[model samples]
Target: MVVKLKLEELKLASVVFHHLWTRRNGLIFQDVFQSPSTVTTMAQVDHVMYKEVLTKDSERTARRQTNEFSQSWKPPAWPFYKVNFDVAFDQASGRMGIGVVIGDSEGELMECLIAPKKHVPSVFQAESYALHRVMELCIELGLSQVCFEGDAKVVIDAVNSKEEDSSWYGQKIEDLQQIMAGYPEWKIVFVHRTANVSAHTATKLAIRVSSENVWLEDDPVEVRRSIMDDLVCNVLNQS
Candidate 1:
């Protein structure tokens, strides 16, 4: 016959059993059963253990539901369009090249390259030159509201800051400031190199190619071809 005993007493016995098991090695249940105090302690321990297991299972189930709900949810749409540009300077040749890609909320609109008249010596200079040319292009295209992004932090900071009058690139800085002033709703930002890879590749190609300039829409094949050519040349030269 099965007997249903009070769980409170069983739990007390379990608690005593747990303490004895932890304190000594090779403990036998016979020793615990023989002691009246130990039997009561073990009953309490078992009750606590059962409660803890139930609590843990409930918590795990709640977490699983929370994760599922989060995964099923969608985020709101972004409000503004973003444009990214990159510039590469050939210090030895003194040639400056610029590459820009414009995109709206829908998708990419255009990409272009400008081979400057004078060779730019530093990456910062090339970046500034690229920004200037991009602003000019935007004006030509009749775009009023846009944002410009580049990989050069120093150039971006210089464009955004008021502490001008630096000896190096003073004229170029002033020209950029004037161009920026012309646009009422334009912003400049610095993007990481990885994010600016396409433009960077285009800029490098612009510098390497014999043609004065190359422009494309929505990352065209010609642009990719030129970039691939540059990559092949680089790899071959290294080998």
Candidate 2:
């Protein structure tokens, strides 16, 4: 019959049983036998190693769970600002729509911009241009400590990398790197689409607006709602 056991007790019993099986195999296959004391010592060593493996597995599981719960927008640390950028494209018109959102440590909107660019060669160029626009705006606004975020993993990775990019958009990435070098405290990060709702919404808005749209401490209704939803998700996840 089977019975439930406390974690430690079960682990000890499993290790002991495993080593006992190994000892039996040695007797049959190799015609070798060890004393009871020797077998017990081997089992004890297996138990210690098994416990260490279990501990590491438990730690990895915990870290993964934490990351899953934190899949929403979060405020930056004190004295720092967070910027999120995104892009949308119209194939028919060959125009790329760009959106950028900036927020303070309190999650309060500082500024936002939605602009349309025409004759962009590719989506990669569009994403890269959006990041470049962010750098210019941050510098113009005099934001010294800023954390730039985007849903474009490729663009973010290229910006963070030290190696030279030789792709079609390599020159743009190089220009961005040179500009970013002047501000040592600024950084760019990649986030999931769900966590970048506000900026993504602004990109959708860019499709309708004829000229560039800028908001100071406020945003369009759709973008504002998205930001509020992020705040709500952040609070729920924390609680």
Candidate 3:
């Protein structure tokens, strides 16, 4: 018996059958015989089956694209003499801290973090706040080429990809993007937590300080001192 199938339906059915056969399962002739009406008249099932197949194909295509994009994506490299900044925030104490370590292709040049009191709720929020603070610091330092590093993946991805604009912090993300746009050269990077230790310490200290007090320094003496003391204590205990 000849069946008249829609062009789209025939293509979809061929695709579906190819996939099914690849799994080592042959089509059941008995099933087709049982559904004689459907098998003999493509009009009986073509429209519904075509839509279902189309949707499945579309979803598969989208997933493949997402995977490809992720695998190929890489952060831009820092330029020579670029100003690099690391920022951290404390949500509990509502304090934001930024540790900027400027360097060139040569080596480390300068470093600083500001402990400013502000109300923040979560680590993610603190990360974003730190980024905003870094931009301000960059402008203040009169540096046009700057790179920012943060431990928070969410914030970095939001700022770099421009995908977070539809989220809760969408407005803030857009604002930061605009601010960064003013600079001829600006880059944001996601770094390992270990590399961000100084900024993390600065953020903790910043939260401890009162709102009236804002700690600004080129060198983070207090944080360095605390680390030294911890190391010394550990050595003494081992002895």
Candidate 4:
């Protein structure tokens, strides 16, 4: 049985449990249970979960969510850097814009990267190259524990797959897997464009720079505002 909370009663609870979901969403999702213990960090909930068999088709409703109640740009736990990447293409010059943004545990910007490429044939190719470049940047920084995400569902799906993807970007996916294998722990997931707005905005900044550029601890004026917006939203989710 579940207990109901009064409008006033919820104000006194240690933590309030909101929308519930099953494990089949294929997300490294964090959930809260109304246990007697006080809620602290996300990792604290791991001990309360159990495995169960579920029909594959039962999760359709979970995937078809409307944007009304969703939260975007969720922050990572301590010591882990969360990276989000996105790509934009210019048809006039056949150039692609790629953006990568890294945020630390406190939702503070760590790095911002934007690059442009010519002769990119499709969005998938641009996204694939963006992922490859992001991984290379992470490797160069010697970052091991990380959570990598992107707004492109197709690209994120292929990056998270263990089996070799045979689509048009087959070789690109293969190379990404090889680079990821070196990390001790990592995550690759897809987020809605709403949640990935900071990275998406950085892609627009690509138009300003003539070549690849990296900025540490700071971003362009537009992306800086976008990052700050996500950071404030993160604080609201925790409260």
Best by lDDT: 2
Ranking by lDDT: 2, 4, 1, 3
> In candidate 3, what are the lDDT values of residues 1-239, reduced to their tens digit?
99999987686567445334422321353231213332323322233444644675676588678863211111224453343344445433445655444444333344455556464434455667767777776787776766666556666787788464444466777888889888758777776444445456666555555542333334457655633443444455547
> Residue 186 of candidate 3: its Cα lDDT?
77
Cand. 4 Cα-lDDT: 0.71
Clashes of 3: 0
Instruction: Show where candidate 2 strays beyond 4 Å.
Output: 1-70
Error of 1 at 163 (Å): 1.3
lDDT of 2 by residue, 70-103 (tens): 3679999989999998999763455899888999
TM-score of decoy 1: 0.55
Report backbone clashes per prediction: 24, 0, 0, 0
TM-score, per-candidate, Cα-based: 0.55, 0.70, 0.51, 0.69
Model 3 quality (TM-score): 0.51
Error of 2 at 172 (Å): 1.5
Which wins on lDDT, candidate 1 or candidate 4?
4
Per-residue alpha-carbon lDDT of candidate 1 for residues 1-239, written as tens digits (9 for 90 to 100): 98775876666556566545533432352232224443343344345545654675676587678863211101112444456677766545557767666655444345566454463334455667778778887788777777777666666777788986544465677888888898878888775554455566667666666655645564556555543443454455547
